[model samples]
Target chain A: MKSADKHRKIIRAATKVFAKKGFFNARISDIAKEAKVADGTIYLYFKNKFDILISVFEQEIGKLIENILLLLENETDPSAQLEIFIQRHLEEMKKNRNLAEVIHIELRQTNKLIRDYRKNKFSEYLDIIAKIILQGQNEGKFRQDINPDIAKLMLFGTLDEISRLWGPGSEEKVTVEDISRQITAIFKHGMLH
Target chain B: MKSADKHRKIIRAATKVFAKKGFFNARISDIAKEAKVADGTIYLYFKNKFDILISVFEQEIGKLIENILLLLENETDPSAQLEIFIQRHLEEMKKNRNLAEVIHIELRQTNKLIRDYRKNKFSEYLDIIAKIILQGQNEGKFRQDINPDIAKLMLFGTLDEISRLWGPGSEEKVTVEDISRQITAIFKHGMLH
Candidate 1:
């Protein structure tokens, strides 16, 4: 298999392993077996389990960022871009529940080193949303006085909490599109009348 | 001394010990030493170390809930209530950084049993916010169509993310009132023009 294909396979396998056995307890040998590759092949692709975990995050969030940027390219209105930004984010998380579980729960339960790494990796993603907020303000589509950092954190934090609660046994029975629209409505227009 | 006073003292000392030594490594003796009480005395107030941690959360968050309810008693406006809610919440966290650090970071990094207990304790606080949102809708202060649960999550999550970032040397250099107003403005008005 190609290096890229092998890399992708390792990530896919690792996501399942980490999600099932958890990040700390999960061994590279387990991931290697799941990926149908030799143990040494895993080392060539990733430095270690920590590298694999970070790689999974970087790849997953990177793809979501790419999708958001691509979707925004054809859209002109900042409101629309913001709405699509939320929609695509929920859609991405919903599409990969295993990855979402790891990112949301397992990674958080890791050590200080992993937590710092997660925070570092997450900053890049936050910058993407920050830029969107900045653009919205520049276009006069968003509130000019609002701090873009706070606004971005509001948007990210809400979606994150929602996604964390959005699991197998949600009583609300809401669809992804439904949730996306609800979140967009709240963000675009305040919850108060 | 009264049983309640000793109980309070034990919790206070445990919060400090847990914050310093971390939850997993913290022992009952360390807490007893800090509280200046006998090891057996702690067992009278709490069943075990885990029980002490949960009680610390219960007392801290319980007091916060009580304060929020008390502040909202005279205020009829939903927006104002929400603002005060955010303010009091931030103020409490600010007053006790060690406890805040333990609650936000250490508890999350603990075992599943602790995590689940934390979740259960947090739901009560979320319900308080949900009631405020529902009351806002009833009073025509908030949008009628917005989901109270989702809005509560937004408010809580935003404040949480902000607190996590807020520390001894934060880059923002903003006051608690400033952040409360910024957050309240977003929840009450939103980002859109």
Candidate 2:
């Protein structure tokens, strides 16, 4: 495999180990096993476990943002862009329960340093969602006076809570498509008139 | 302190430790030290670590339910009852952030047996919120077609997400009461006309 592919393999492994065993409890050995890389091979690519975590965060969420941003560019309709973001977000989450759990649930367990890094990286993530809302508001699709910051929390928090409710593995009672649709409806129409 | 008061102290201490460290990482020694109780003394009142979690859940949530149920008997007006439920639920969550974190975040980490116990105990918790919604629907204050199950999830999920975001220990930007009031206003007036 190419160097980039090897890097991705390491990250995929680290995410699972960190998620299943937690960041503190997860060992480099466990990550190595999950990735199928030699224990020492991990050292060749990253400085430490935290580095792997940062890599995973940047790689996973970065790729996601990049793809969505590309999608936004091609999709001129604001509603269409928003739907695609929601739909794709749910599908990605469904594909990787461990990654989703680690990001939303376990990652918060760490102290200040990791959290600060997350907040910094999360700006782009936040900005993308804010951009969608801004596009909607500007185009008269979504309501004005909706603070993108608070709205992001509601939007993000709703999805996170719903995903958690579905637990470690979601059954078909609520599909990613189902969540995508319901959240889109809520974003558009809200809970009531 | 009286034995009853001492028991309450231990319960609060356990909640704090469990919330901060989570169930798997939190040790009985830490909880006992925080509670100012002997390790063996814990066994006098409860069976084990699992017992402490269940006890904390019962004592805190059970008392809150009793208070709410008693309060509801005097509140015949559906709207007033709804307001009170929201206010008190917010207040309860604020006063018991540790307990909230433990139950909301940690309890889900348990195995099937404990999850079963939690499911049974959780219904009682849900009943408080569900009963109010049912009353509102019957009184023509809320939409009759809204599924009570879905309504509870929406309301509780919204409130829980808000609490975690506006959590007391959170570096998050808002106050619980601010989010609570804003959410309640949104719930009532909604995002659109």
Candidate 3:
């Protein structure tokens, strides 16, 4: 296989290992066995376990943001764009529980450096939400007085917390599409009359 | 000091130690030393390190909930009650940065048993928010169609996320009161016009 495919394979295997055993407990050999690759082959594509974990976050979230940007491009209404963005996010997580678990649980490292990296990746996500909120404000859809930073936190935090209920090891029975609808409604219509 | 005071002293010391050195790296002897007590004295007030951590959570959060319950007793408006609740929550965190850091950063242990305990304690918090939401719905202040559980998550998660930006190690310039006001406004009017 090409090096690109090997890289993807290693990342996929690492996600499972980290999600199952957590970032600290997961061994590089466990990931190698899961990936059906040699231990040295794993090193060829990644620096260390931390590098692999960071790559998992960077790659998965990068794809999510890219997908949201693509979906937002053809949509004229910022509100509708926000809705699609949320819907696609839930759908993606629903489709990939391993990825969701790794993103939610395993990424929470105790190290300050890892935490800083996670924060940077999270800021990228917030930036995407900020842009959508800004567009909505400019278009007179969202409230003009709302600060984009605060608004983005509200939007992102809500989705993230709800996602926790449906990720791997969760017992919540709510369907992703249904929850997404409920969320969009909350965002579109204020909780008060 | 009395045994009760000793219990409180140990918790306070552990909070500081845990905040500085983290949960895993912290030693029971360190807590005892900081509290100015013998190592065996800690076992009298607590079972072990985990118990000390849990007690810190239980005592602090239990007090917070009790205070909110007391304050909510006199407030007729559920919305105002929520505003007060959010404000108090932020104020308490602002007042105690050591506890805040330990709760936010150090308490995130990957152990399943610890996660279970955290969830149970968190459920108590969720219950408080749910009651407020339900009360608002009954009073026709909040939308009756809103799911109290989801709404609670949104409120709690939003505050929790924004709190991270202002916690002990955070560099964000936003004040606790100002951010609390912004959060309350979002909970009330939301992002939409």
Candidate 4:
């Protein structure tokens, strides 16, 4: 197999292991076994388990960011853009449940290295929401008084909290479309009558 | 010291230890040392570390619920209720940074026991938000179309995400009042002009 293919295989296996056993409990051997590779071979591609976790974020979130930017490139209406962003986010989480689980639970690690990486990469992902709000304000579609920073946290936090219900063992009955619509409605038009 | 006082002291010590070392790394001795009690005494009031964690949630969140209910007893306005909720949440998190750290990071543990406890106790905490939305709807202050479940998640998630910035090592510059006002404005008036 090509080195690139081997690298991808290891990452996919690591995602599963990390999702099931968590970051601290997961071992490199488990990842290698899942990937059907030798323990030493796993070391060839990544420095350690933390490095693999970092790569998972780098590769997955990098793809997500690129894909989202591409998806939003032609959309001019900020409202439509926000809706698309929400739809895409929910769709991705549903489609990649394991990845979603890892990101949701593991990313909260208190280690400085993980925290620093989250601040950089995760902030970039969150900045997408702020940018959308800024666009809305520039177009006069949103309130001028809205603070993008706080609004970004609200939107992301709402989405993050909502997604937690979709995790394993959760018996959520709401459809993704229903949730997307509810969130969009609330954010686009305040709850106040 | 009295039994109740000793129980309270051990819990306080456990909160500090868990916040510092995390759930998986913290030992009973660490908690005992912090509380200035014998390790055997911990087992007397609690079955194990997990019990202490659950008690932490029960005690802290229970107090939060009672305090908020008391504060809102005299206020008739739903909007004011929400503002008060936001304000109180930020204040509690700020005042109890150790508990905040433990809840923000530790509560995500994948243990079934913790997860079950979270679903029960944490759901009650979140239900407070849903009740506020339902009250607003009944009073004709909020749009009737809003789903209380989704809105509850949004409000709690927003507060949860925002509070994460207040943890140790975070250089967040926004004040609690500023955040409370911003969140209240967005939820009340939304982003739309």
Candidate 5:
């Protein structure tokens, strides 16, 4: 296998291992075993288990950020852009339960390294929402009084809380589309009649 | 000291210890020392460290639930009740940063016992938000189309994400009141013009 392929294989395996056994319980050897690679070969690609965990987030979230930017480029209306963002976010989590579990659960690790990494990458993801809100305000479609910073938190927080229910072994009665629609409706238009 | 007072004192000390040291790193001896009691005295009030953690949540969150219930009783308008709810929730977190840290970070622990306890107590707290929405719909003040379950998640999730920024040693430029107002406005009136 090429170096790039081997690196990708290890990340994929780590996502599954971390999701299954959690970051603290998961061992580097376990990741190597799952990847069908020698334990020594694992060190060639990554420094340690913490390094692998951070790599998992960096790669997955980087892909998500890139995808959202590409997807949003085609839409002009901020409202529609916001809808697409919610739909895509929920859809991605629904399809990638392991990555979602790893991101949701492990992101809360109290370590300074993970916390700082999360702050930077997570803020970048959240900035997407803030930009949408700012665009809506500029277009005069959204309320001027609303703060983009707080609004972004509200939007991401809602999507995240909803995702917490989508853990493995749990059956969800609501479809991802249902969640996207419900969430978009609430944020686009206030709950007031 | 009275048994009840000693129990309360130990809980207070444990909150500081748990906040300072992540739950995994925190020892019963640390809690006992902080409380100025013998190490064995902790086991007298609780079964183990996990039991103490749960008790802290139960005692603190239980008080929050009780207070919100009492405070909301004075207001009949659902909108006003929601503003009050958001205000009180954020205020409690601001007043009790240690409790906030423990609840915010420790609640995400992957253990089944903590997870189940969190689901139950956290749901009870979130149900307060749902009940407000339900009351608003019944009063014909809020939109009838919204799902209280999803709305509750949005409200709690937003508050939670915001609270994550309020960890110790960090200075927040935005006041708790500013956050509550901003969040309440977005949820109550939304972003759309």
Candidate 6:
């Protein structure tokens, strides 16, 4: 396989390994075994275990950021754009449960070094929610006094909390639709009547 | 120290060890050393490693439930009750940061055994948020159509997400006031205005 294809292929394998063994327990050998690549081949595209983790996150969340940007670019209305963003996020998690588990549960295990590498590398993805909140405010669709940063946390926090609410047996308790609706409400309307 | 004092001391030590090293990484000897109790003294109160782990969780979250129940008895207004509950919850976590970390981050490493154990044991604390929503709906303060279980998750998950959001360097990004206010809006009136 070409380097790019080989890189994607390795990341796919690494994601599974990280999800299964967690970031702490997962070793590069397990990743190579799962990826069907030589151990050295893994090193060709990445530096180490943390690299594999970061590669996976950058790929998944990068795709999400790119798609959301494309959506916001095409859709001018702030409210519609915000709703679509959250719906897409929930659906994305649904499709990539392993990535969801890794992001939700595992990435947390990484120390300052791993997390800082991520903060710098993925600042764009991190700002997507902040950008949307800004868009809403600019369009006069959201409150003006709200700080974009806290607003960003609120947006992502609501979606994240909703995703988390769908725990092990959450399939039976609630559908993703239910969560999306609540996200729309809390995001648009400030909580009080 | 008396037996009760000794038991509390052991539980406190277990909380720190489990929080720092995680359940799998932490050993009884480490906890015993921290508690100033010999390893054998631990076996006297608890059966084994698993029992100690369970005891640690129970002692920590059990007090949380007790505090919640006590609040319910004294606080009548649903919204007021929620505000105070949030404040107390933050205070409680501040007091037991290690225990909070263990519950939020570490205990999730176990298999079905600990998961089932927690679900059975802390169902009341788990249900407190649901009860708040139900009370709000009955009082006509919250949306009449809200699902209490999902609502419960949204309430707890949002708070939990924000707490985690304050990870290492998220100090200035948000505050407890923002968390409490946003959660109140999301829970009481919901996302949609």
By TM-score, who's the top model here? 4
Whole-model lDDT, model 3: 0.78
Every model's TM-score: 0.84, 0.79, 0.89, 0.94, 0.93, 0.84
Error of 4 at B73 (Å): 1.3
Q: Which stretch of 10 consecutive residues in model 3 chain A shows the poorest summed lDDT?
A: A104-113
Cα lDDT tens digits, model 1, A51-115, are: 89888877877777777788889987778888888888887777787767676655544434465
lDDT of 4 at B147: 89
Residue A6 of model 3 has an lDDT of 88
lDDT of 4 by residue, A94-166 (tens): 7787778677777765344487788788889999989999999999999998889888888988887788778
DockQ each: 0.54, 0.29, 0.57, 0.79, 0.76, 0.35
Model 3 ranges off by over 4 Å: A37-41, B27-33, B36-46, B106-108
Model 2, span B1-193: residue lDDT tens: 2488877888889999988777767899999899888888887777888888888887777888888888889988766676677777777777777767765665545523365665667767776767777877777776564555545555666666556654544676556556666566555544443
Which lDDT tens digits does candidate 4 get at residues B1-193? Answer: 4598889989888888887778777899999999998999898899877889888777888888899989989897888989999999989998887778677767775444478788787888888888988999999989998989889989988987888778878788889998998888888877788
CA error at residue B61 for candidate 2, angstroms? 2.9
Q: What shift in Å separates residue B127 of candidate 4 from its native position after superposition? A: 0.9
**Candidate lDDT (C-alpha), each:** 0.78, 0.70, 0.78, 0.85, 0.85, 0.70
Error of 2 at A8 (Å): 2.2
| C-alpha RMSD of each candidate structure in angstroms | 3.7, 3.9, 2.8, 2.0, 2.1, 3.4
TM-score of chain A of each: 0.86, 0.87, 0.89, 0.94, 0.94, 0.87
- Compose the digit string of candidate 5's lDDT tens values, residues A94-155: 88977787766677654445767877887899999999999999999999988898888788
* lDDT (tens digit, per residue) of candidate 3 on B45-153: 8887788888887777787878878988999888898998899888877777666666665444443446777677768878888999899999888888789998888
lDDT of 2 by residue, A1-193 (tens): 3498888889888888876766766799999988898999999999987788788777778877887788788887777777888787777777777667676655455423365776777667767777877877788866665666666666665666556555543344766776677666555554432
Clashes of each: 0, 0, 0, 0, 0, 4
* DockQ class, candidate 6: acceptable
Instruction: Determine the TM-score of chain B of model 2.
Output: 0.85
* Rank by DockQ (best first): 4, 5, 3, 1, 6, 2
Interface RMSD to the true structure, each candidate: 2.0, 3.5, 1.9, 1.1, 1.1, 3.4
Error of 5 at B35 (Å): 2.5
